[model samples]
Target: MDPLLPRPVQDLGHYRLPSWWTPGAPRWRQALWLLVGLPLLASELPGTPWRQWLLRLFGAQIGAGGRLKPRLRVKCPWRLVVGDHCWLGEAVWIDNLASVTLGDRVCISQGAYLCTGNHDVRSPGFELKVAPILIDNDAWIAAQAMLAPGTQVGAGAVVALAAVASGLIEPGVIVAGHPALVVGRR
Candidate 1:
């Protein structure tokens, strides 16, 4: 093998998912949540109240008066929490393999992706790793932005369009670029 070449996974059987992680509800209940609950929650036909009702019914901790817009995908409703008057815009994907908490008045704009799971590249088995994500009060994640695992966006911060947030964002800052840097203060 060439020294510069990356090592491939030796044993796929050694891969193991985190023991702490579980589908919050029973298999049947989870199935129902995915099949029945998700569609209704993602529909534009149902207003905020109806969408919120569906989310709550599936065990998500959604506060009052938030708008969950059409076509948004939430992997695990039980692992999500959104505070009062938040807005999740169209086609936002919350891949919450771990917990994702959004504070009051947060706005996640169209096509933003919040991901809480990744793989350890150094591990021979390519082991899975997960961490929680937090978007504090009044933070705005603009269109097409991606928030990686363990990221914390501070209060009133803005992640600009198509940016990727892989670390902590200071309060009242505006960030832009692929790795997301502070461009200005809010």
Candidate 2:
């Protein structure tokens, strides 16, 4: 939330976005990405390179030798940067209101959600809040896991399935559970 342009409303019905609020791109571009992604790029075919190409066209900086599987949903590819040899599994949702960076050899397993946006509950309007997420090299985000905003997953770390991770995760650690506690080391 922008403290500079905050709109404190008395009720939820009266809530409105701050004048400075923007989706970081034109509405048309956002629609176009959906049009291309849902129909073509997200297809359940054998064209990983084509999918990556389409993502690149939408301003995603994707490196080589990566596989983005079917049903992956990337909200605003312009805010995304992925490195080489990465694997984004099926149904992975990257709800990036801010930047999301994934280093080389990172694996985001199926149904994992990477959210760069949240709401400030303290605000009257439940104001939008955003922060960047950085997953370092060789990190493994397992299936159904959720990475919250501002999460910095360290290199070679493993976030176990269904774990919800936030803040900084140390390198080579294997984390599990709701808040992602340290279970082992890679």
Candidate 3:
């Protein structure tokens, strides 16, 4: 094997996924969540109440009056926390490898992705890294936007369409563009 050549697929043993973090549910519960809970939650026919009930059953801490639209995908309900009157639009994917918390009246628009897991590119092994995401009260994540690991969307902040948000967003401001920047005040 040449030292300069990139290793074959079988030789790539450097990558390691963390075993300490559980999805906050037992194996059976996780299986049930994917098999039954997801389909029900993704259906419009079940309505908000039924969908909410399914999430609750899977251990999500969803507050009263929250509205999750059809096609919403939550990686782990047990690691999710949604506050009252929050709205999750169609095809919203919360890849909460760590905890994801949404405060009161937070709105995540269609096709938005909230990711709490990333790879450490600086490391040769490309280690998995996990961090929580927090969207404060009245924060709005616009359509197709992405909130990266460890980001905090401040109270009343607005992340504009298709933006990539990372790090902290100041309270009551509008941010846009890739690697989102403050565009204006709310």
Where does the lowest 10-residue lDDT sum fall in candidate 3?
A: 7-16
- The TM-score between candidate 1 and the true structure equals 0.91
lDDT of 1: 0.89
* Deviating ranges (above 4 Å) for candidate 3: 1-14, 44-46
What does the lDDT come to for candidate 3? 0.90
Q: Model 2: which ten-residue window has the lowest total lDDT?
A: 2-11
What is the per-residue lDDT of model 3 for residues 62-142, given as tens digits with 9 covering 90 to 100? 998977788889999999999999999998999998999999999999999999998876566666799999999999999
Selected candidate, larger TM-score, 2 vs 3: 3
Cα lDDT of model 1 by residue, 1-186, tens digit: 667766654457777776776766789878997888877766667467777877888889999887888888888898899999999999899999889999999999999999999988777877788999999999999999999999999999999999999889999999999889999999
lDDT of 2 by residue, 1-186 (tens): 558755653357756776766777788888998776656765677668888988898889999898889988889888899999999999889999899999999999999999998877777776778899999999999999999999999999999999999999999999999989999999
TM-score each candidate.
0.91, 0.89, 0.90
